[model samples]
Target: MQYRMLSDQRKRWVDCLRGFCMMAILLFHTEIYYTGTSIIGYNLYVSDALYLFFMLSGYLLYKKAGMIDIKYKLKSVLRNLLWPYFIFTSVMAVPKALAHGERVDNAWALVQNVVTGQASWFIAALIVAEIFFVVALRLCRGNLFALGSVCVLSFCCSALLALNGNLVTFWQFGNALQAMLFLFLGYVFHRYEHKLVVDVWPTV
Candidate 1:
């Protein structure tokens, strides 16, 4: 059937995108480990995988949250994010903490790192960003102007923090702003999918 064929095509594209992202991240991290510098040629796009990642996550999660019960979604997200964070910090980071002779034990050390944005910080940040997204969506209540104003405010605050680094222990504040922007874009795209172009090469 046509539906089956379309589903298969989508799966293939998703797999291809996933593999490409994995390869790109591996190469970028490998380069960072070795040269401590640029990505040879095609530096801009190649080095910005995190941006792509954030946008895709935003888009997918927005679609999913719309489709399912938000409470269940929240529970699932917490379970998925927190368990790995705890394990990764405890198992992987505790050893490094021990080797470094830091006076903190595994649990306390993990808590400190998570709070300070030094250990599995992206998950923490993303969790906060998702909360913010939900809150904004609720408060805005389909008022695009209100949403846009809040986003503008978030961006301004983030830029201000970047300019003045005093008492800024975490970079994820700015990241949350960027995430919100991308998430908003995703939500809009979902809402307007019928109006907008959806093709291999999308317009606008």
Candidate 2:
């Protein structure tokens, strides 16, 4: 059997980081709604765990793309993410619309909710980010710098658009852009793991 030192180390480190993020998410959700305040600064960290989770996802998927069929991966994502999103959101929207005296069979209304992210918005943003990343990877031929530039431009666009939240549907697109940025950062971290050392310190 052959052993790879850096690969093993990176895998263990990423796993541990994910475990920590899971715990943080658990704690954040448990307390955030009821307490309405910070828990020893965990509040500050809570918002970041989601971004880190998305980043880790991108890092892993980018590596897998090089090893597997991209078309199959894209189809799997579409089936798993978008399909469920549409079904569940439509199911919820129709009843809610009835209760509110809105038209019961409004396809445009359903699509607007889906696009404006009235459903599971996070999942919608994630689906868009994943699809965008996968397509961009194929076009860029896995060029990290080119992809990174795209992510940077996305961030700039998000910032500029967010400033006019009244006009643009900034929240949805801003979140998607930020998700892409974090995903790209995760890919960068994985690709350069050999040169990076992550350190942790006890909070005293």
Whole-model lDDT values for every prediction: 0.63, 0.71
Best by TM-score: 1
Q: Residue 40 deviation, candidate 1, in Å?
A: 4.1
Pairs with steric clashes in candidate 1? none
Could you tell me how far off, in angstroms, the CA of residue 91 lies in candidate 1 after the best superposition? 2.3
Clashing pairs in 2: none
C-alpha lDDT of residue 94 in model 1: 62
**Residue-wise lDDT of candidate 2 within 29-106, one digit each (tens)?**
567555765564764776677788888878777564264357887898879987888788877887667654678677
Worst-scoring 10-residue span by lDDT in model 2: 195-204
TM-score of each: 0.73, 0.68
In model 1, the runs with Cα more than 4 Å from the true position are 1-15, 35-47, 64-70, 94-111, 166-171, 196-198, 201-204
Predicted candidate 1 versus true structure: per-residue lDDT over 58-103, tens digit per residue: 5555543344345766787678866676677657676656555565
Error of 1 at 56 (Å): 1.2
